[model samples]
Target: MNQVWLRVAQLEDADAIAQLVNRAFQVERFFIEGDRINPGAVRELLRKGKFLLAEQSGALAGCVYLEPHGDRCYLGLLSVDPGRQRSGLGTLLMGAAEEDCRAAGARGIDLQIVSLRTELPGYYRRLGYEENGTAPFPASAQPKQPCYFIRMSKELG
Candidate 1:
């Protein structure tokens, strides 16, 4: 594996970030929309929060978006390159995101996973996140089937 490093994404990274996210989320093929994200959407997200990117040998490998809200930070759009999945990069990104939130003075970190992705809740649970509740899926998502968000949170000590 190449030397991996994390950094805050700049506006210039929107295109690469979108490509990486869309590729990683291609598993969402069951949804009404085939692609998980677009550069325009990524650009929009950049306006609201920061994106942490993981690069390997100068190639974008993974990323997660963080938006601070009062005592909590909302983490979302986590994506690892399809070729790099199962290599523990996701776990590293999760840890980094939590530490970033903690360093920002957040008391907790929050995230939402698509309810349809049955495997995700357990994954986050293993990372110390607990499901708090469910929220209606975003209208923009246009899910093909009934879908909602599984809200999860992890307290930072």
Candidate 2:
């Protein structure tokens, strides 16, 4: 991979980001995917200053949404374009999200990963994230998913 840059996700990137998010994780039978969030929602996130995008040479590569809550930030809807996977784009997005949280005075950043993705937890662990506990992916709140969830956290040091 070449040099990458982080920027605020714009509404215009919503379709591209939606395709990336759905294409990346929609195949898993353990969870029924949610409708790709509306571009308006992405715009709102941008307005609230909660979203970030990763790019290389002006191409959208990856993204993560951070919801600040006091000293902790909730990370959600993280994704990297399949065409750009295995190239450290995910790490770049995570790093940028953490920085965003820290800049907002967050003490820690956390995410909920589908517990059934056996390899996913290890991936986050390698990035210095730890399993904080297990949580339910409420079929109602979550997208009709059968998978359990695990909360993971990385301290902002």
Candidate 3:
């Protein structure tokens, strides 16, 4: 699909991104830290210059979060609009995020997906991510329900 590809994110994108995230995960929002997610935190996340949005015909098709993790970077909130799935947009965004990280000297890419989302881990594996086992949750990083998220990582080229 022909669309605008950019990493521009303003405070205004927060609500839209939140809505998209809410719809994408729904009952699985805990894994997303949705309970802890708000416009303010979204703004901070975006301010790090990692969050990105995909726009098609002036509307957002997907959103992603790429928070820096010391030498590595963390990929989270990889949500695509329900209507926009199966269009290769997610893969496109993932590539862009990975490329950006590589350019920034990240040794690897880290991710945390809910263990319950068995299909998602497999999906990441297909994209070259490998399971590194359950990662610890900082007492302040997120909520309690998604306590034992599976950690995955991919070494950058």
RMSD of each: 1.3, 2.4, 3.1
Candidate 3 per-residue lDDT over residues 93-128, each given as its tens digit: 888888989998999999887666767987888889
* TM-score against native, each model: 0.94, 0.84, 0.83
Model 2 poorest 10 in a row by lDDT: 27-36
TM-score-based ranking: 1, 2, 3
lDDT of each: 0.91, 0.78, 0.80
Extract clashing residue pairs from model 3: none
lDDT (Cα, tens digit) per residue for candidate 1, span 1-157: 5678999999999999989988989888787577777888888899989999999988999999999898889999999999998898889999999989989999999999888999899889999999999999988767889998899999998
lDDT sort, best first? 1, 3, 2
- Report the poorest 10 consecutive residues by lDDT, candidate 1: 28-37
- Model 2: residues >4 Å from true position, as ranges? 33-36, 47-49, 141-145
lDDT of 2 by residue, 1-157 (tens): 8899888866678777766666666545455656556666676776655668888888777888888777789898887877888998898888888777888889998888876678889899998999989987776756553678899999997
Candidate 1, residue 50: the lDDT equals 94
